[model samples]
Target chain A: MKSTLKKAGYSRVQKQMHDVFLQFTSKVVFFIIIMFAFNLFFAGHYTPGGGFVGGLLAASALILLLIAYDRKTLFKMIPIDYRLIITTGLFLSLAVPTLSFLFGTPFLTHQHTYLQLPVLGEIPLHSALLFDLGVFLTVAGTTLLMIALIEGEES
Target chain B: MTTDILVLLPIIIPMFAGLIMLFIGRRPMAHRVGAALTGLLMLIITLWVIIRVYNSGTMVTFIGDWAAPFGISVVIDMAAALLLLSTTIVTFAIVVYSFQSIGMEREKFYYYPLILFMLTGINGAFSTGDIFNMFVFFEVFLIASYVLITLGGTKIQLQEGFKYIVVNIVASNFFVLGIAYLYSVTGTLNFADIYLKLDNYDGNIIIMTIVAVVFLFVFATKAGVVPFYFWLPGSYYAPPMPVIALFGALLTKVGVYAIARTYSLFFIGNSAFTHQMLLFLAILTIIVGAIGALAYTDMKKVIIYNILIAVGIILTGFSIMDQTATVGAMYYLIHDIIIKAALFLLVGFIIYRTGKVDSERLGGLIGQHPLAGWAFFIAALSLAGVPPLSGFYGKLFIVQSAFENNHYIAAIILLLSSLVVLYSLIKIFINVFWGEDMDFSKLKPVKYDKLLVSSIGLVIVSVAFGLGADLLYPLFEMAAEAFHDPASYASYLTEVE
Candidate 1:
């Protein structure tokens, strides 16, 4: 497979130029996506959108990167394992409910409190938001994993 | 509240363990140990919950802080507890059996995690008190099973798995539609709430009956009963042994459990009409399953038919809709889960050692693999409803229920089908175990001790369940009573905290 690919491969200069342009566009898209993802993630606690949507948006950004560049290039750019992200997210999400058990609440029973921070003003903290972050990471990780796998398979 | 918290353990333990196993990556030994430990913990937790539920009656826990009717609730009744226990038992056995049975490559591909996730779904489905929550859990298990089925990415697995997914997706749509219709009409999704609303609704019963039929079709498809059962044998035939064992043991039973739960709780409004339809479906399921079993020469396909027979039997008990009949059904359901797992695992062993699934290429395995042969013999007998085995009691109770209700045709059919079940199983036995002793050298040599022990563990459980039925009868009685009276369960929603 590699020999055939090498034999067919040509015009490295054009490919590099295209990748440079693609990289430029993907970065812009990535920034906008991150902005929207975090916006949705934070706004979710107060409104309609939350971790799932943000996570999905974030995943879409990753998918866009895959489409713009090859999986190998994208992996080199991100340098992060999606599977590990998924496991971390799962543990985080699981920990949210588990924390409640420590406080004699049922699984997934969340509470909100106000905490004064020196750098930031009084912050309203809901344990569920943490759980939502876990959900975000999980959804994002799994979605990216699927895309990465299929991309890897095709390449 | 604590009891409610306890009900969440089965779901959480497996979910957590499965998640943990995901990170264990590529280490087959670690995955096996992690999965086995998880399975054992789940079994212990399930048994504890069962004992607690048996002592205290049904325990209901709402998810988060939301109350029943508004949020998802998990209810651990005698029936649910029994199902949970059976699931954990089979899970533990299969987890152990997978060490020798499942390929190492499959192990590295998150096999253990998928099984645990599936168990989480099964446990949640059984214990959830809400209808929609049941749907969510059903999806959980279905997706997990789908992944497990296609793990090898074999051509057959992929082809059959696609069909399985399509069928389930359609059935799930019907399930959701049914739930939507019921919710729109009754304005509730809680099982108990629906029971109350259904009882109070004085409007036209026709729409409700239609909803019941839709729900029945959905569950019947899941359970692999007649007319809707065409997908089972082919799909189940594709997966590896331990997976097929898990599917044979727990998956279809989850569907049966859903049917029994909904029918007992909400379908009683038009019992005369709805139940007559159910009885006809049940009898048809039996006849079709038996015919399919008799027609199949392949070991896996034949076992798949036995699974259908179990489904038909459980549905028959539900269709009879009497205390005795429900008890019989519950007994059979439990018996079948263990026995079927044993049978599937044994067949998987036979296939692995002999490299043949068809009895035509195999003969006289009892001469060499005495333990497996005997174990298969015992499981086959139990499955066939032979006397003093657990299967016998379930058949007996159903038969007695039929006689009591003067459904002589049903009784006769039940008896004749049991004989057919015996004949079909015996044919496999005679062909594979008794005739034309083959040289042991020609067969692939592998470690059979662990797999044999796991198979025997369940076979012994079946025998003990049978002999100890006198002691276990009260539990079944309580389960039956709980099935008969939804009011007792419904009252929980009205109890002011």
Candidate 2:
């Protein structure tokens, strides 16, 4: 979360206007990206949008933040390590397949179940969703890490 | 279901272990112990699979309970099982060796995990019955190997890694392109299905030849055959000993195995042309490989070129395309896996002791490292096809089959290359292990009993393969049978139908 980036030579653009219009646009983009990613992930199993697209959306949000407020401010707001996120994603993806082994099923065989809830009627849960979430996290983490490494190297 | 589980276990075990290793805490000791245990478990599973497949005939397992041609399937024929077993053995030895030899920093950066991942890809490649799945598995191992080759991040390794990556990327493009051409004609990606459908598509001879040649180029690049082998020597010479040992033992063989599988199963439409091409390229491979070995003074380069020589021998046997030649190729394949790995490790040990890998700078290591020197001598002889060694029997069967088939020129090249192989290796042996001792003031002392033990274990297996050929011939026969008849192999899928 520390601001190791200095306001000097390697910044791609020095045109930070510090205007309210820019601030409002950034906030709107951030919120839209979050909701879009959520919708893409949860609806991935039965719908067109999936973990891969959702994770890419999440990465784009981070890039937007990087541009709006600079990396130092971005890091302060989101204090998560991309590498750790990558590891978690990797574990989640592997765990789903390994879990099938316990049930004496083939690796990566998905089992689905529906639960009748009070508010959300007949919500279907799938093991594949867990795999999708893993893909999402991994893609997001990897893309962000690559950006960070390239950015840091330049500066 | 039980058989399905067994087929799935070999590929899944290492994959799950590899992924788990990535998330584990930053303790190198735990990762090492975990990787070693994973390797041992794989060894046992592969051995069990080999035996089970031998007894039961070819067994096909459809993943996710879907039948063949519609879903991915794992086919465990005797040949595939044997390959899986040999690859697993070499991987286990390399894993154990890496524990002490690879530095802690590299291990911490997902080295063990990458090894397990590499094994997963290799096993998957060998077992999968689908051609596209083969490409998928190839990519898995390709990515892992790219990381492994450049893990140390030295100047030379980086240079070599770039070239290696570029070559593989280009080859992979051809792989996908060739697959597209194949699927367009046959309308299926499954190996058995494609073979069954080959009869229906009789008019596209030119397109089929193009597709087959493209695939042959792809595999030839991978196997480091003559025209495409320039990238292999520098890339292999760049990696560390354990990594190079793994590369020498398993990587190129995967390519050769793929060629054997596809050419036998599906590309029989133009065998006269295709097999002739294989023979011509194989002859070029042998000559270039022998000359490369003779040309190199660096110990590692010599070993690398020797690898190319083994490739030529195996391809020659494969191109002859008979049961005897197939068995000989299998024998030579397994033997080369063991002895080549042993040679690399032994040479690495010598380099560790002498602080240099070039032959001219090293001399009289017999006094200081007699065990390694003798191990090297035996392995070299084995590589050169001396009698009573594993390499000789492989050469014998190959030559016999060639003469029987009236391939006198191939038989001559096979025999002549054996002598050239002998000369090149003996030149290295005398130059490095005999004569006056080199100065040792700059040598760094590291304990090597553990490293030597693993290398010795490999040497023992290589020797056992020679001395126990009587006991192992039946197994080789079973493997050869799998390749000798494509009908029986294709029937594994047709059984349910």
Candidate 3:
């Protein structure tokens, strides 16, 4: 059957199936771990955990996927370039505060505004969140990129 | 709006450019676009910073709406702004210069983002009001630099880069430990807040002294002072000329700026201990750096050693603790960045032409490459403190200020070091440019690339600074004013809040 699969162009599909199964299972387990880490990060912000830890957790999720699957498969799964993630993260981090300069305020001046949604309720969008999201993306992207480079070199 | 933007713009503009570059940097067209946009944006922002700093006392920005004591802020006084302006200028020059010197393969990958990130770290370090934030930014910059330094993955680069990374990591760990102790003592990361809190606390002088000494060691490693400077010559000479030029120009200066800021604001109260230590370090650094310069035969090594000399001079300014001495330090810092960058770029050009940086194999290119030779001569003279040039003014100011402050020993060491620097630079000039004409039959005539020419243009601007000192002196004076007046920075942030 393996020989048949290899000869019939099913090898690619077979390998991909094996890869996908491994990735999906690991991702599930990894997602749970990350969710746990995220909760801990949120609770520990005033104590220890913050953007850096949260970002590291997200990166670890990607690392888990990389471990379970091939680079090409993993690259396909994560469509956005790690560089873009890093850059966008940095931009978001820098931009939120820069907006304050426009309003004659100092940089990174966190202004909170509650947006009235049509049905859900009021959503509080604080600039600090944007900065945190930026930090998250940068850390995750940078970590993933480093992992990718090391993996690429090793292969 | 003008003043606030002026303060924020230098940092914001480069950051934005950096972000934009990250997306489009893979495309050939994007490289040009990124370079042009970054250069233009930097130039405009620097000009705005200069104008605003001259007109309005100092600019301050608070991050996240938190007041000065509670949250992070970025303050851009004349000194910070001037450093920002120079950083932008050197980055712009190097980026333009990279167009030709860096291969297309490299430009597509690391060149633009690394530079932009480097600038971000530099600008962040310069503008940040929080000491911890300064450390964070320093890490940001250093991490990028580690990548940039090791970008090509050559054996020599890998070896030297490893040492550089290890040394910097150790320094960083020390920096973090210092911050921890500082926070434990003062319970604040804000520079001004720490200053205000520490002013009243009569803590154990011994603990404070140890922390201060540790802080000095961390910065000294970064700034390439004396015993901590071995990594600089080897690592700096490992990378391509353009990378080395940028590193030579800005990295140590950022370290020096941190020292200057910390010493002036937080540590000023303990001047008797801190200043004396700095005075001793400065003199030792000068003597050691000059001797190193005399010993090294490689052009890059000599330049790196000269950077140590510049560090010594700048430290001497910091050590004296007088207003005039600080001003001299400020001027010297600015002059050193411009001249040293120019010198490194000139060396890059020579290497590009000669296919070698060693003086042993290279000879008699003065006539063949007159432009490169003369540029090297001017930059070397400026570095050695030749009269009527930028270097001379900086050395003269420091010497005068040191003498006025009764630091005659430091003054004399500075002067004697300048003479030693002169000898080493002249040694390069004689051997590389002026000695007997070597075999040219096999040698390819060095074609001056446009990027190389643009770098020379930057050197020309530094030379112009020398020629037009009268015009630039007022700006330096304003910068001196800004550094001395911590109240202005603190009050500005508080008022905004």
TM-score of each: 0.95, 0.94, 0.90
Residue pairs clashing, model 2: none
Best by DockQ: 1
Model 3 lDDT tens row, B326-384: 77888789888887888888878777776787886789988787887888888888888
Weakest 10 consecutive residues of candidate 3 chain B by summed lDDT? B1-10
At residue B488, candidate 2 shows an lDDT of 75
Off by over 4 Å in 2: A1-24
Better of 2 and 3 by TM-score: 2
What value does the lDDT take at residue B117 in candidate 2? 90
lDDT, candidate 3, residue B269? 65
Docking class of 1: medium
**Prediction 2 global C-alpha lDDT:** 0.86
Angstrom error at residue B433, model 2:
1.5
| Tens-place lDDT digits, model 1, residues B448-475 | 7788888888888888888998898888
Tell me the whole-model lDDT of each prediction, alpha carbons only. Answer: 0.87, 0.86, 0.80
Candidate achieving higher DockQ, 1 or 3: 1
Report how far residue B37 has shifted in candidate 2, in Å: 1.4
Candidate 2, residue A118: lDDT:
95
Residues B1-497, candidate 2, lDDT per residue (tens digit)?
42367887888889888877776756788888888899889889998988888787777877766678988888888888888988888888888888778888888878888998999899999999999999999999999999999997889999999999999999999999999999989889989888888845677788888888999999999999989999999999898899999998999999999988888888888889998899889988998998988898898998899899899999998888899999999999989988999998888888776778889877887877788888888998998899899998889999999999998988898899988888887777888889788775656688788789889889988898899987888889888876767777888767778
Docking quality (DockQ) for each candidate:
0.50, 0.40, 0.41
Candidate 3 residue-wise lDDT at A75: 75
Better of 1 and 2 by DockQ: 1
